[model samples]
Target chain A: MSLARLSRSQQSNRLPELLVPAALGTLMLIYFAVPFVAFLTRAGTTNIITGLSTPEAQVAIRNSLLTAPISTLIATAFGVPLAYVLARASFVGKRLVEALVILPLIVPPVVGGAMILTAVGRFTPIGSAAATLGISLTDSLIGVILAQTFVAAPFVIITARAGFGAIDERLEQASRSLGYGPLSTFWNVSLPLARGAIIAGIILTFARAIGEFGATMMVAYNPRTMPTRIWVDFIAGGMDAIVPVALALLGITLAVLTAVQRFGRVPTVIDR
Target chain B: MILELKQLTHRYGDELAVDDVSFELEEGELLALLGPSGCGKTTIVQAIAGHVQPTAGRVVLRNRDVTEASPEDRHVGIVFQQPTLYPHMTVSENVAYGLTARGVEPNQRDERVSEYLELVDLTEQWDAYPSELSGGQQRRVEVARALAPQPDVLLLDEPLSALDRQLRERLRKEIARIQTETGVTTLFVTHDQQEAMALADRLIVMNDGRVSGSGTPRALYGSPPTPFVASFLGRSNTFPATVVAQQPPTLRVGTHKLTVSNQELSVSAGTSVTCHIRPDGLSVIAPGSENGTALSLAGEVVTVTDVGRRYDVTIRTERSDEFVVETVERPPEPGEEITLELPRDRITIFETHDHDRGSTTGVPEH
Candidate 1:
C-alpha cells in the first residue's frame, strides 16, 4: 500500500478510541459559544450605537464600570493581609478561617446577597447604625459594592496567598539579616516577590465584581448595575432589548478578562 | 570578647537542641563550629544570629547585650548553606541589598557593590540574574552580598557545604582571604572536619547538643581530649589501657615503655585510661634500621592504595590496631610483615569510668 493510504487507515483505526472525549469536548465548547455568539451577532455595531444613546443602557454601563472597581479596591485592602496570614502563619483555627474564606465562592450568589442583607439591611441593627451615620447599604451603590465585594474578595485572597506561599522564606530571613526590619522586609522582599500573584488576584477580583449579578440584584435593584439593568430591559423588551446590553456586558468583561489573563501570568524575569 | 555566646541554650519543643554552649571570639578571629548533622552546631550559629532565641544565655557582640535584639538590629551578615541569593535580582543588586536596606546613597552603594563583586571574583557576573549564573558563581554572589554589609560580625552557616569539592576548597580559601582582608570576626559552621581545619583559626567540636571539645585545629587533631573528639577531628587510634607507669615523662603501654614528651600531665599509675595516638604521629621505620620505634608493633600489610599524590597504606597490627598512613614511597605488599612505630610524644590519655565503654576488653569507644 502507498504511505498516504496506510497513514489514513491507521488514523481511522485510532479514531474510535478518541471519539467519546472529542464529542464531549465539542459539546461543551458549543454550549459555551452559542449564547456568546448569538449576543454578538444580534447586537451589531448599529445596535450598540443606538443602545448607547438610551438612558437606561448608558446609566447601567457607567454604574457597573464605576462600582466594580470600587469593590475591587475594597477587596484588596482586606485581602492582602489575609493572604499573607494564610500563606505564612501557622495558628489554631486556620482551617476554620480557610473554610470561611472559601464559603462565599461556593454559596449561590443570591444566597450570599440574602445573607448580607440579613446582616446589614435597612431594618437590621448594623443597617440602622449605618443609617444614623449617613451610610445606606440596601438599595444604594454602597449596597451594590457590599454585594460585589462579598463575592469577589476570596478570589484575590486565594490567588495572592498562593503567590506568597511560593516565595522562599530564606529570602525574607536574608533581608532581615541585611538590616531591613520586619515591615521593611515585607515591603522590599515579600511584596515584590509576590506582586505577580497579587496583581492576578486583583484582576480576578475586578472581573468577579463586574460579573456579579444575583447578589447585586438581591441587594441593590434600584442602582441597577449592568446585569440588573439587562434583566429589567429583558422584562420590558424580551430578547430584543436584552441582546445589546448583554453584548455590552460581554464586550467590556471580555476585554478586561483578556487584559487580566495577560496581566496575571507571572512574568519570567529570570529565565527569559 | 568581640563576640560571646555565654551559656547559650535552646530547646525545640521538648527536645534540647543546644545546651550551655559557651565561647568567646576575639576581634578578626574566624571560629568554626564543627560537628556531624543534628549535633546542634547549626542551633548555636542561629542562636548567635538571633534567629533562634536561646532559652538561657546572653549573646554579646562588641560588649553590647543583644539577646533581645532582632536579627536586623544585631548587624550580623550571614551566608546560608543554600547561597540564598534573591533569584529575582541581578548579582550587583544582590550585593547592594544590604547597603540599600541601610539607605546608603546610590553612589557609595555602587562603589561597595563593585568592590565586593571584585572580592568574590565575580565582577563580570554583576549584571546577570542568579538563575543565569553557575552554582559556584551564585555562591560567590552570596559571599559578596554578605561581606558588602561590613557588619560588626559575620556568620557563615555551612556556606561551602553544599558545593562540590573543588568549589568548596576554592571558597574556603576565598572566605579566609576575605575575612583577613576585611578583618571581620566570623563564625563559620560546618559538618566537615577538613573544612573546619582549613578555615578556622579556632574550632568548637560539638556532639549531642553539647560542646565535646574546643581548641586550635592542630591542637584538636594532635590531642583530642575525649574519644568523641579524637574520632570526630582526626583518625586517631584510641584504645583502653591501664596506666602501668605515670612518670612525668614516661607512659608504658603493654610491655613497651612509651616516653611522654610533654612532661606536663601526670596521671595516676594503675588507673584505667583511654590512649589516643594520631595516625600522623606514627612513623614507619625500615626493618632493622636501629632508629628507635618507641611503642613498636609488628603486623601484616592489609592494603596500600594511592590517593592523590601520596599512598595510603593500611597495616593491620599484631594488636589489631589500624593506621591509615600517608606516605610518599610505595609500601610493602599485602600479607607481608610490617611494623608501625607510635612515637613517644604524640598521645592523649583520658580517664573514663562510664559504662558506655561497652566493650570493656581493650575497648575503643566510638
Candidate 2:
C-alpha cells in the first residue's frame, strides 16, 4: 500500500552506482559556482560601484539593454508564429524550414554575420535596395539589431516550438467546439496553456542576444553594445576594465535566469 | 427533431471510419452510439459536431446543411472523455467559454454560468480551477460547460468512463436526469453496454464503421436484429437449432424442440437457424411437468455461481446445447438433473447465415 517503498529504496541502494556521476556533476557545479561567487564578492563594495560609474560602461550598458531586448522582441514577434506553425501544421518542407531556422545556431557566429552581410549588406542586392531607401547595415543600430536577431532567433524558435508542441491538440479542438474562433482560441486557450514555455523561450532568446559577441563584432563594431565594449576593453584596457563589466553582466544574467527558473516550471508532456 | 445525419461517411486514408451512417435524433432523447472501439460511434458524433469531415454526407441541424461548416458555425457542444476544461480558467469561466467567445456581454454570461453551475450542483465550486476539482467534478463541469449555451445537439464521448465503477453508475443516473431536464438532442458514445442501455432512449448499435441496428433499448435487447445485438446487449445462450416444426411464435429444434419466436427469423422450415434465449427468461422445473405445451429440455447443471442478486446456473443439455439460467431462488446443485423450460415468446431465432457475423468472441475472460 505504501507507494514510496520502491523509489526510496531504489535511490538509496543505487547510491554507489550513481556516486561517480553525482560527484562529477557536483564538481562541475562547484567549479562554475566558485568563479561566480568570487566575482560577486570582489564587486561587493569596491570594484562593483566603480564599474557602474564609468561613462563608457554606462553607454555600453544602455546600448546593451536597448538593442538586445529590441531584437529579442522582434525575434519573438516573428519566431513564435513560425514555432506554432512548425509545431502544429503538417506542410511540405517543414523539416527543411526548421533545419534552416536553427542552422544559424550551429554555424559560427562570425560566419553568420558574414552571411548576413552578403545577403543584406549595403552593397549586396537586398542591402543595396535598403541603401536605396537610405538605410545602412554596417556599423549601425539596424546592423546590431539584425546581427542579434540572426544569432538569437534560433533559441526562441527552438524553445517556442517545443512549448507549442507540448500542448494537447484536443485542447484547441475543444476551444473551437466551445465557440472560440481560430485566432481567439489561440489567444485565450493555446497562448495561456503554453505561457511558461513561451516565457522560458523569451528568457533564452534574451540571454543569447545579451551575450552575443562574434556577430556583433563582425557587423557593428562601433556603436558598442556591452559585449562589444567588453571585447574592446579586454583587448585595450585588459582585466582592469573588463572584469567589473563582466561581473555586472553576470549579476543581471543570474537575476533573469533565476526568475526564469522559478516561474518557467512547465510540465513535460510526452505526447506533445 | 433536433439533429440529423444523412449518409454520413468518413474515411481515414484507405479505411472508412464511418460508413454511410444515417440517423435522426429527437429532442430530449439521449441517443447512445453503443459499440466497441473503432466502431465509428465517435466518428459519427464528430461528423455531426463538425469536428470531422465526411467524405460523402450531410449533417443537418434544424433541416439546414452544416456538413461543411466549422465546429463554431455548427453551434454544437462536445464533451470529451478527458475533461477538456480550460485549466487556467475558473469553473464559471469554463462554463461561459462558448458564450464569451460569441461576444456575449459580461452580465448575461455571468448569469448563465451561475445557472449552469447550479444545474450541475457545482455552484460552490465556480471559483475553483479545473485542477482543483476531482475527476467526477471536472466531468460535471465539462457537462455544465457544454450545456450552458443551450446548443441543440450535445455530443458526449464516454464522459464517465474514466471514473470508478461506483462513481460511473452514480454519474450515469445524473446525466440521464440532466438530459431529461434540458431537453436537448444528445449523442452519447460508449463501449459499455450497461451504460448505453441505462441512458439511451434509442440505441444505435455500430460495428466496423457501419450501423448494425437502431431502435429503442428494449427493441434492440428483446428482439435483436442479428446475433450480435442478442449477445451484445446482454447474456445470450446461443444454440444451433433447425426448424423441425414451425409456427408463428414457436420453433421445434430437433428432438429437444425448444420454443423460439420466428419474428426475428426470416427462414423457413428445415432451414438451420441460431436460437438465442435470454438467461433470465429460462426457468428450471421438474422434467415432464411442461406436459408437451412448453419446450422443456432435460439437462444436468454443470456450474452454479452466486452472481450477487441471482444464481447463474449453466446446464448442459443432452442435445449438446448449454442452457444458462439466472434465478433469485434456489438453483439446482451441480450434476443435478433439471428441466429448463423455454417459453415460446422469450426466445429469438435468427437465420444461421447472420449468426456470429459481428459478435466478437475472445473478450478477456473475467
Candidate 3:
C-alpha cells in the first residue's frame, strides 16, 4: 500500500478504542434529553396556556412560589452558621452532628416525613402547644414548609461547609492580626470568599424545596403545591391533564437557574 | 526594648517544639530569627504575634504582657509567608483593611493606604486585583497592607522564601530600605542565613528548638559560640585537633602542628577541640614566600572552580584532610602541589564536646 493509505488503514484499526466511550456518552445524553424533548413537543403552547388558567393550577402555583422561597430563606439563615461551625471548629460529638446534618440526604423522603411527624405531630407536646395558640401544625401551610425544610436544608449545609473548609485559614489569621476580631473577620473575609458556594447551595435548596412531593404528601395535602397539583391532575385526567403544570415547573426552574448563574458568575476567592 | 520573649516554651502533644527560647529586640531594630525548617523559628514569631500561646512564658510588647491578649487586641501587623491579600478587594482596599477595621475615617484611610502603597512603590497598581499583579508585586502589596495600620511592630515570616533568587535579592534590599525608612520594630523569621546576615541588625540563630547563638552578623560570623553557629552562619572548614601546648596556643591536627593567638585559645594543653577556618581566610603562598607567623601546609590541588569574581580552589593536604581556599589569584591545576597559609587570628577553636553540638559537619565540599 502507499504510505498515506497504509496510515489511514492503521487509523481505522485504532478508531474503536476512542469510539466506545463516545458512543456510550452519546447514549446517556440522549437518554436524559429525550423525555424533555418529547414532553415539550407533545404539549403544545395552546394546551399549556389553557391548563395553567384553571383555579386549581393557580392556587398550587401561588403556594409553591410563596412557600419555597420562605423555606429557602429559613434554611440559609440557620444552615450557613451551622456549616461555618462544622467547617471551622473542633469539639466533642462533632462527627455525630455532621452525621445528623447528612441524615436527611441519606434517608428516603417519605421516611424523613414520618420522622418529622413523630416529632411534631398534632398529638405531640410541641404540636399541642401550637394548637393552643390556634395554629394547626399538620394539614396546613406550616406543615408544607416543615416538610420542605426537612428534605431540602441539607444541600445548603453540605455545599456551604465544603466552601468554608476550602478557605485558607491564614487569610483569617491575617485579618485577626490586623486588628479585626473573629466575628468581623468572618463578615469581611470568610463570608465574601465563600459567597459563590453559598449561592450555589441556596439555588439547590430552593430547587429541591419547590420540587418536594413525597414528604409534603405525608404531612400536608390540603394546601396543594405544584407537584401535588400535578399528581392530582394526573389521577383525574391522565397525561393530558398534567402536561401543562410539568411544563410550567420546568420553565420556572430554568428561569431561576439562568438568573442565579448570571448573578453568581462573580469571581470566587481561589478562581485565580 | 520594643519586644521581649522570656522563657518561651511550647509543646505539641508530647513533642517539644520550642524550648526556653528568649530574646529581646530594641526599638526600630530588625531582628531575624534564623534557623532551618522545623527549628521553631516560626513558633517564636507566632508566640510574639499572639497566634500561638506558649505552653509557658511571657510575650511582652512595649512592656505590656501580651501572652494573655488576643491577636486583635495586640495591634501587631504581620506579613505571612504567603502574600494573603484579600482577592476580592483592590490593592488599595487590601491596604486599607486594617484601618477600616479600626474604624479609621474614609479620607484618612485612603491617605494612609496611598502613603504605604507609595512606600512599597506600588502606587501605580493601586486599583489592580492581587491576581492581576506579579508575585513580587503581590508581596509588596502585602507589605503595604501590613504597614498601613501602623501597628507597634511588624512580623515577616520568610517573606522572600517563595521568590526566585534575583527577585529575592531585590526584595531583600527593598525590605532593608523599608525598615530603615519606616523604622518599624520588626521581627523577621528566615531559614536562609544569607538573608539573615544581609537584613538583620542583630540575629538569633536557633537549632532544634533552642538558641544556638545570638549577636551582630560580624560578631557571630567572626566568633561563632558553637560549631552549629559556625557552620550555619557561613562556610567553614573544621578539623578535629588536640591542644598540644598552652604557651602561644599550639594545636596538633593529625601530624601537622599549628599555632594560634592567646586570645583564640581557651582550653589548656591536651584538650580535644575543633578548629574552624573560613575559606576566604586561607590563601595560597608561593614557595619560600611564606610569612613566619602564619601556619603553613603543603597540599595537592584537587579542583579549581571559577566562581566569577574569585576562584574556589580545593586542596588535599599531606594529612589527607581537604580544605577549600577562596582566592582572587590564578588557581593551580588539579594534581599540582602548592603550599596554603592559615593566619592565626582567623582561626576559631571550639571545645569538641560542647553541649550544643549540631548536625553540621562544617565541611562544605561534602
Q: Tell me the native contact fraction for each prediction.
A: 0.76, 0.78, 0.91
lDDT of 2 by residue, B9-46 (tens): 99988998888889898878889999888888887877
**Alpha carbon deviation, residue B271, candidate 3 (Å):** 3.7
What is each predicted model's overall lDDT from 0 to 1?
0.82, 0.82, 0.87
After superposition, which runs of candidate 3 have C-alpha atoms over 4 Å from their true positions? A1-24, A266-272, B244-250, B256-259, B262-270, B286-292, B352-356, B359-366
lDDT of 1 at B285: 66
Off by over 4 Å in 2: A1-22, A38-55, A255-272, B243-252, B256-265, B268-271, B352-356, B360-366
Per-residue lDDT for B56-118 in model 1, tens only?
999999999999999898878888897578877899999999998887899999999999999
Cα RMSD, each candidate:
6.1, 3.8, 5.1
- Clashes in model 1: which pairs? none
Query: Which model scores highest in TM-score?
Result: 3
Q: Can you write out model 2's per-residue Cα lDDT over A18-126, one digit (the tens) per residue? A: 5688899999999999987886665555466777678988988888888888999999999988899999998889879988998999989999989888788778888
Better of 1 and 3 by TM-score: 3
Tens-digit per-residue lDDT, A1-272, candidate 3: 37656676678856555467779999999999999788777887447888999999999999999888888999999999999999999999999999999999899998888888888889999999999999988878899999999999999998899989989888998999988999999999999998888888888898999999988888888799999999998999988899988888878876776787678883432231
What level of docking quality does candidate 1 show? medium
Roughly what TM-score does model 1 have, to 2 decimal places? 0.85
Residue A130 in model 1: shift from native, Å? 0.9
